[model samples]
Target: MAELVFDYLIIGGGIAGTTAAETIRQKDQNGSVALICGEPHFLYSRVLLPEFIRKEIELDKVMLRTAGDYKKNGIDIFLNESVCDFNSQTMTLKTISGKEFRAKKILIASGGRPKLWNFETLLPGNIFRLQTLDDALKIKEFLSSRPSGTALVVGGGFMALEFIAILAKYGWKIKLLCAEKYFWPDFLDETGFGILKDLWQKNGIETIFGREIKNSAELDADFVGVGIGLDRNLDFLPHAAIKPPSGGLEVNEHLETGTPNVWAAGDVASYKDRFSGRRRSGGNWSGAFMQGRTAGLNMAGGKESFKNIPVYAISHLGVNISFVGDVGPFDEKFGVKTEEIRFDKEKKEHIKIFMKDNRVIGAVLMNGQRFLGKINQAIMNGWADSKITLD
Candidate 1:
C-alpha cells in the first residue's frame, strides 16, 4: 500500500536473513535497514525443530529474536509479508499483500520450503510437513490426541530420522521409508549407515532403505507424512538471473547475485564448491548464518566473501553424529584411503574417515563428539598440507 526506501532490504527472517540484517547493522549503523519475513513469528533455529518436537526445548525458547529486539537494533520489521515479484532494473519488490517497496540493495535470504507429495490433493487436515513452526505445532496437536494409529514418515535425511526417533519415544508404531542406500548419502558411508540401521532396529522403528513410495496407497497408516526433499524459493524471481544445476539463485563468491543491487544466501543461493568441483546449495543453519552475514556486509557497501567449509551434524535419541569436509564415494582416481570402523557389539557406533596422502580429508562419526571438535580444528588448520605415515 505504501512505498518505502531503505539502504538494504532483506526478504527473509530465517537464520540467513536475520544474520544478514545484524551484519548490515554492525557494518553501517547509520544506514536504514528493513526486514520482511513471511512467517508471522520471528526467526527460530530450524535445526532444533526436531528437538522442539521431542520436547527438548520450549516453544518460547525457540524464537530467535523478539520484535522489541529488532526495534532496539534499529531495524524495520515487517511480518507475514512475502515478496511475490521483484524487478531488478527498477530495484522494486512487491509483497503478496500488494505492498510495494524500493531499496538501494536487496538480499534474498529466503530459505527453502518442504517439498510435498500429491500436492494437488486436498487432504491437508491429516497430512503435514515439518518445515515451519506452525507445521510442528499442528503435528504436536495431532499427537496430543494420542491417536490410536501408526504414523508413517517418508524421506531419509536428518529431519526424517529425528521425527522417527521422536515418534518412537511416544510409543507410536512408526514406518520410516528412505529411497536411498544410506540414511544420509551426502554425509554417511556404508559402514556409518550400517550403524544407524542397527540403531533403528534396536529402537523398533521400521526402515525401508533403497525403496520409495510408488503411490499414496502404499502408505498404510493413520497419517502419512511426506517430506522427501527440499526446493528453493527463487520461483518468485526470474529464472534468467540464475545459473544452472543449482535450482537456486546463482551467486558469486561474495554472495552477489547477478541481479543488480541484489544478493542471496542460505538454501536459496548456490555457489560452486572449490573442492568437489560441483555447485552446492546450503540448508544448514550454521552455513546459512555465515553466508547471510557475508551477503549483508557486501550489500551494505562493505567487503565480505563466503568461504565454503561445509559441516553437517545431528543428534537423535541420544546419539551424536557429525560429518566435516569433502565426503566422496571411494574412488581410485582421487587417490584416497577409505577406512570404516565399527565399535562395540551392544553400542555399535560407526566411524569412517576419508584420507588423501595420509591426512584426513573427511570423516563421518556416530556416537562420537570428542573427535568432531578435533577433526573440525584439523580441517580448519590446514593439516592437509602435511603428510604423515600411519600404522
Candidate 2:
C-alpha cells in the first residue's frame, strides 16, 4: 500500500552501483540502502567476459558477489527491474512495472549501452554486441551452434579489438573494419597506430581501414561483432539534469549532480577531474569504481574528491595495451603535447605521453604495464620529464 523508502537508492547494478551500495552500507550501518538492477544476473565482472567466452572460467566464477553476500551487507537487491522515470524534486523513481521507490539520496550509475549501427536491412540473430553478461552468453551460444568461420569485427576501438582478439583465439578468421584511417584514431598517435597495425597484420588479422559497415551484407562472414561504441544510458533523467555541450549528467569533483541530494557515477556521469582540470566522461572500470566510492563517501557526509588517473588495459596478441589519464584526442584548447617513445627491438614498446602545462596528463603504454605505477606517480607529483626511456 505504501512505497518503499531508502536512505540511499542506487540505480544500476554494475560495478559503480554495487560499489556505491557497499560503501554506503559500510559507512552507515543503519542507513537503508537498496540497489535496483535491470539485469537478472547478480554482480559479475564484464572484464572477464572474454575468458567466459573461451570457457576458461565458468559462469559462477564471473560473479563478483552472491545473493547471500548482498543480504549479509544489509543491501536490498532488486533484480530484473528497470527504472523508467525519476522525479528529482521528490527524490522518487518508478520502475517500468509501476513499482515506486523513494530515496533521500540517489546515485545514478546506470552506465552505458552499446551504440548500434543503424542499417536499412534488418540484422540476423548471428550478429552480436558485447556489453552485458547476457550478450556474452548469447555470443557463446551462437559460436557453439555454428562452425568456425570468419568473424567480421566492425570498429577500431577497444571493444572492437577485444572482440577481434577473442574471435581469433577461438580460431575464427577475423577481419577488422576500421572506420577511421587508423586504429583508435582518437587516442593513438601515428607510431602507436603503426605498431598496432603491424601486430594485427602479423597475427593474420586482415584489417581494412577507412571503411564503415553500413550494410550487414557488405562482408561475407559467418557472424559479425559490432563494437562501434557506447551511448550513455540517461534517457530516464529529467531534462534539467542533463548537462550542457555534452549529454551526460554533469557532476563536480565530489560526484554530486546539479540536483540536490542526487549524484552520478560511472559512464553516465561527465565529471570534473581535479587532476586534469577538465570535465570528461569515463567509461573505464577504474574511473567508474573510484567515482562510485567517492560518491558514496560524499553521500555519507564525508568530504572526498576523486583525483585518480584513469587507466584501461587490454591484452591482445601477447601485447599489453593500456591507456592512462586524459589520453583522448583533445582539442588544442587543452594545450596538450604528445610525445611518442619507442623502446629497443626486443621489448617493442610504444609509449605515448600526453602533457599539459608541462605536467604529465595522459599516456598510452604498449607492452609496458609495469611502468604504469611509476608514470602515475610521476603525473601526480608533477614530473615534467619528457623523455621516458625504459631499459
Candidate 3:
C-alpha cells in the first residue's frame, strides 16, 4: 500500500487555503496541490455568515469558489475530513479516518475555531456560534422556528455587533454583554465607544458592559449567540517547533514557520508585520487572502513578503465601522500612539490612527470608506505625517 502525496498540502478550506492553492496552480500548473477542509463545503466568505443567517442572501451568494473552480484549477479538495496528526520530519499528515498524506511542502491555514464557554448545565438548542456555514445554517433554522425572541449576545467584537444587528433586524429583543467596559476596547477609544453604545441603545437594545456570566442560568433568553473570540486550530501539530501562542501560530515575514518547507496563513498564522514590525494574527479577509498568496509564492520558491496592513469593515444597524492597520489598545510598554479625528460626532464620522515611533501603523475609520485606500498606502509607504480629511 502506497500513501498519497502532493507537491503542496494545505489544511483548512477558508480564504487562505483556497487562495494559496490558486496561487500555487498559477505558478506551477502541473504541481499536485491538495487542500483538506474539515468543513463540508467549498471556499466561502465567513464574513458574510451574518447575511446568510439574516436570510438577506442565498447560501450560494456566500460561496467564494465552487467545486468546479477547484476542479478546473486541478486542485484536489478533501471535504468533511479532519487531519488528526502531522509529522514534520516525514512531511506527512494523518487524518482521523486513518488516511495518510505526504507532501513536499505544507501550509497550515486551519484558521480558528469559535471559543465557547464551559458550562456545567447543558445548553439549550437555541445557543449558537456563527463560525462556519453549518453554524449559520443552524442559526437560520433556529430563527425560522422562532421568528422573534430575546437573544443574549456575548462578547464585544465585530461578530457580536453583527449578530446583534441581525437579530435586532428580525424584531428580536437583544441584550449585548461585554466583558470590558466598552465595545471593542482594543480598538475603540472613549468617544468611539460612547458613540457605538448610543447607537445600540437607540436601536432599543440593552448594551451592558463589564459583565461576566459565571453561570448560564443567570440570563433568560430564547437564544445565546457567543462571539467571544477564536482559538487557533494547531493542536494537531503539537510537536512542531512553531508553538501555538494564545494569539496563533507564529510565523515570519515569509509566512513560514520555524520548520523548513512549512508555512501558515489566515487566522492561524501570527506573522510579523513588515510595516508595523509587530506580530499579529487572525485578521480580516483581505489580509488573509494576501497572506495566503504570499505563503504560496514563498513555498513555490518565490521570494514574496507579506506587507499589507490588515483591514476589516462592517456595516450594522446603520453604522459603518472600518479598522485598518494595528489600531491597538496595546500594552503601555509599547508606547503605541493613537489619535482620533472626529469629523461629525453626531453622525459618528471619525478616524482614529495608531502609530509607533512616529509612523502610521493602523487606523479605525468610522463611516470613512473613502480614506481606506489612501490610509493603507500611507502606512505602507511609512508616511509619518499622513493627513486624512473628511470634506
Candidate 4:
C-alpha cells in the first residue's frame, strides 16, 4: 500500500541486522537506512532465550536494542513486516502487507527459524518450538500452570540441551532423545561425549540417544520440546540460489551475494570461508555478529573481507564444550583423515583434531581448553605454525 525509499534496506531484526544497521549508520551517517523485521521486537538476544526461560536473567537483559536506539540512529525500522519477494532488476522488495521497499543496496540477514515437524500440517498439541522470545514466554507461561510435569525433548543440538536444563530447573522430569548415538555425533569423540553424558547424569537428566522423533502421539509425556534445527527464510527469494549443505545464500569473502547490489549476513549467509575451505553459514552468535559488521561495512562503501575459523561453545549442566573449524563430518569425496589428541585421564578431558590431506581442518575440545588458542591458530594458519606440541 505504501512505498518506502531508502539508501539501504535490511531484512531481519535479529542481532545481525541490528549490528549491520548500527554499523552502516556509523560509517555513513547520512544514508537513509530502513530495516524490516518480521517480528514485532526491535532486537533481542537469541543466545539468552534459555537464560530468560530459567529466569537467570531479567527480560530487560535479553532485549539487546531499544526503540530509542533505532530512533537515535535514524534507522527506520518496520517491525512485524516480513519481505515476501525481492526483485533484483528493480531493486525493490515487497512485504507481506504489500509495502514496497526500494533501496540502492540491500542486505538479507533474515536469520533462521525453528523447523516444525510438519510445515504443511498444523503443529500437534503440546509440542514446543523455541526460537523466539515469544516462544520462551509461552513456555514460561506453560510451566506456571503445571508445577510438575514430564518434558520429552527431542534433539542433541544446543536448544535440546537448553530445554532439558530449563525443564530440570522448573522441577520437571525430562526424557531426552538424540538423533545420534552421542551428543554432537559429528563433532565429539568417545571421551568428549562421556564428559557430557556424565554431566547430564549428575544433573539427573535421563537421555535416550539415537531416537529421532517419528511420532508425537506414541510418546507419553506432558509436553514435547523439539530442537531439531533451524531453517533459513529463503522461500520468498527464489532469485538467489540456495547453497546446499548450509541452505543459505551463497556469498563471497566480502559477504557479497553474487546478485548485484545485494549482500547477506547472519545464519542466512553461506559465505565462502578462507579458513574452513568451504562456504559456511553463520550458525552461531559470534559468526552472526562479526558477519553483520563485515557485511555492513561493505554495503556502506567500505571494503572488508570476513576471516573466521568457526567456533561454537556452550555450557549446560555444568560442563563447557567447544567445536571449532570444520567440526562436522567431511564429505565422502574428499580424502579425509583424523588425528586425535586423545583424552587426558588426569584432567578428565578430550581433544580430537580432524585433518584432510594432512591439513588441520577441525578440532573438538571438551574441558581441554588449554589448547584452545593453539587450535584456533592451527585452523587459521597451519598446524605446524600453531606452536602446539601434541603427544
Candidate 2 — what's its lDDT? Answer: 0.84
Q: Write the per-residue lDDT of candidate 1 for residues 1-391, one digit (tens) a residue.
A: 5698988899999999998998889888899999999998888877777678777789887877988889988999899998899898899989989889999999998888877576317556677688898888887778767754788888877678767766876678888888887687856766677777777787777888798767757766766677677877776788686666667887888988877788989998887655444567877778898899889888878666688667888777668887766665444566766676445445656666666766666777787666666666655554552331121
Model 3 spans > 4 angstroms off: 239-246, 385-391
Instruction: Specify the poorest-scoring 10-residue window by lDDT in model 3.
Output: 239-248
Report the candidate with higher TM-score, 3 versus 4.
3
User: Which parts of model 4 have CA positions greater than 4 angstroms off?
Assistant: 119-125, 345-347, 384-387
By lDDT, the best candidate is 2
Report the lDDT tens digits of candidate 4 across residue range 1-391.
7789999999998888888999999999899998999999879988898889888899999998888999999999999998888888899989889899899999999988888575214445577889998999999888877777888888878888788888988998888888798887767777778888877787777888876656546467887888888889877888437878878888888899888889999989987666547667767888888988998899999889987777888777666677888866667676656666757755657778877656687788777667788888787776642345654
* Model 1 lDDT-worst window of ten: 382-391
What's the TM-score of every candidate structure? 0.89, 0.95, 0.95, 0.94
lDDT of 3 at 189: 84
For residues 1-391, could you state the per-residue lDDT of candidate 3 as single tens digits? 4688999999988899999999999999888999999999998998888888888899889988888999999999999889999988899999887889999999999888877577413675767788888888888888888669889998899889878977977889999988898888888888788778888878889988998887768667888888888877777877454453425778888898888899999988887677667677855899899988999898888988887767788997887998887776577887888887655787788788888898888888888888788788778877774455445
List the pairs of residues colliding in candidate 2. Answer: none
Cα RMSD for candidates in order: 3.0, 1.7, 1.8, 2.2
Model 2 stretches astray by more than 4 angstroms: 387-389
Candidate 4's displacement at residue 78, Å, is 0.5
Q: Highest TM-score: which candidate?
A: 2
Q: State model 1's lDDT.
A: 0.77
